[model samples]
Target chain A: MKVELTLFGQLADIAGRTKFQLQDIPDTDTLQKKIHEMYPEMANMSYSIAVNKKTIHENTVFEGDANVALLPPFSGG
Target chain B: MSERKIKNIFSQGPIPATFIAESIQKHSSQTAIGGHSIFLGQVRADETEQGKVKAIDYTAFEEMALEKMHQIREEIFAKYPITCMHVHHSLGQVQAGEICLFVFSSSAHRKAAIDSCNEIVERIKAELPIWGKEIMENDSHQWKVNK
Candidate 1:
């Protein structure tokens, strides 16, 4: 399965792209591990994982064709 | 209660003063609204160790931000007796001294409008999934976190 991944703020700068498709991801837990493997620097930052626009703290099974976003702490005014 | 429709709260670049003026003008006919409270967020230029901050470039998970904002709006309306509320935030680059956020709330009395407006501003800062990159004059940058 494939999922659309979005990187925001500093994460986007580190990842070098805002949006992309990652393949062969079975669940969010595994997808997170793969992301950490690809971007080691991301491990140091505190971020929340959102699958299909809702933040999930626990391991969640990807429903497939979902949009995943790595969001850092909000700073909007 | 019926679900309120989510609004597009984003505007590209800085928010213009004329737009704000027009919004205020549009409310003149609402005689029932005796009080209006407004909050305007302006980008501040701060001197950092690397250089002076020049502007802020904002980004967001648009789908989620709008969803979260709508939830907050619903909660505020349920809690307060405000007549109406409006919230707008800037995306892309906003230069220093330019407006980035506009929150306006109106009510029959002053207290509800003031309190709800304040709460909405705080909620937007803490809850919205928006990110900002502070660009320095010397081309350096850092991620902004609400304090």
Candidate 2:
């Protein structure tokens, strides 16, 4: 399965874009695992995952209709 | 309950103190409160760990920030005996020594007002989808948060 990932804040700068796609991830957990595998530098970064703007933790069953975003800690007032 | 008035978010330059003062004036009443407390978060140019912070570039996921602000207002109202509350935060680039956020709360006593002000500011800092870039004099920058 393929999933779209949206990055924000410092992560967006690191990734060099606001949005991208990941293909062939079997599940949410694998998607996360694969992301770390591809970008080992992100291993130490704290970030949150949102499926369609709602934060989710653990394994989320992606149905291909949801938009996933990786959000770093917000520092603005 | 009185009507909700004034803006909770701004995308321009420095936040005017009059906005906060006006909000307090509109809601102040001898019957409703005897004390009011406010917390104003000023942007500082000095970055303790990363050297001098020249300025801060503030940005927000506006849709989410507003939703979170409304939720915070509701929570604060429910948690305290406050008669009124106002929260305004700056958006876009703000230089050091400028106001970033202004929170005001009025209650029957001083303690609750102070406590409410602190809580609201804390929650806003922790949960809101706003980001700040700490720009140094050398042009190097980092996200403005203690990790």
Candidate 3:
């Protein structure tokens, strides 16, 4: 299955892109690992993962096509 | 009536001072509200090693932020005896010294209006998934971190 993965804040700058599709990524942990492999600089940065607009704490298996987002520290007023 | 409605608070760019005045005037008919509290956030120019910041480009995960804001609004209303509340934030580019966020709260007494307005501003900063990129005069950019 393919999932649309979006990166926000500094994560997007690090990734060099914002939203794209991921194929065959099983869970959040795998997704993070793949991103780190592609952009090693992202490995040291702090971020949060959200699936379908809800933030997730632990690795969550994808049951179907999902919308995933990588969020860096928010700075809003 | 209490609200569960999701309010769209994002404005295109800088929030004009006239819009804020009009908002206050709209509430004049609701004379039951004895006190009104207002908060405005302005973009400040900061000098960085690269250059001086001239403006800010603000963006947000809009679909999620509105949902989060709805929850915050509900909680604020439940905790404070506020009769009315309104919040507005800016998207796109806002120049330095321009107003970017506006929050207003009204109540029968001064305390609830003041307290709730403060709380709402705090929550918006802490909880919303918005980001600001400081655009420098040298054409470089830096991400903003809330202090």
Candidate 2 chain B: worst-modelled 10 consecutive residues by lDDT: B1-10
Model 3 ranges off by over 4 Å: B1-3
Candidate 2 lDDT by residue in tens digits, B28-125: 45576888888888878775565788778877767767767777887788899987777788887777888888888889889889999999988988
Q: Which regions of candidate 2 fall more than 4 Å away from where they truly are?
A: A23-26, B1-10, B28-31, B48-50
- The iRMS of the candidates, in order, is 0.7, 1.2, 0.6
lDDT of 2 by residue, A1-77 (tens): 67888877888787788888887766678877887887787778998887777778788988765577777897866
Better of 2 and 3 by TM-score: 3
- Report the C-alpha lDDT of model 1 over A1-77, residue by residue, as the tens digit: 88899888888889999999999888988988999999999989999999988999899887667889999889998
Off by over 4 Å in 1: B1-3
lDDT per residue (tens digit) for residues B25-93 in model 3: 999999899999999999998988878989999999998999899989999999999998999999999
- Each predicted model: what fraction of the native A–B Cα contacts (within 8 Å) does it retain? 0.96, 0.57, 0.82
TM-score of chain A of each: 0.95, 0.85, 0.94
Candidate 2: Cα lDDT at A66: 55
Model 3 DockQ reads 0.87
Give the DockQ (2 decimals) of all models: 0.90, 0.61, 0.87
Better of 2 and 3 by lDDT: 3
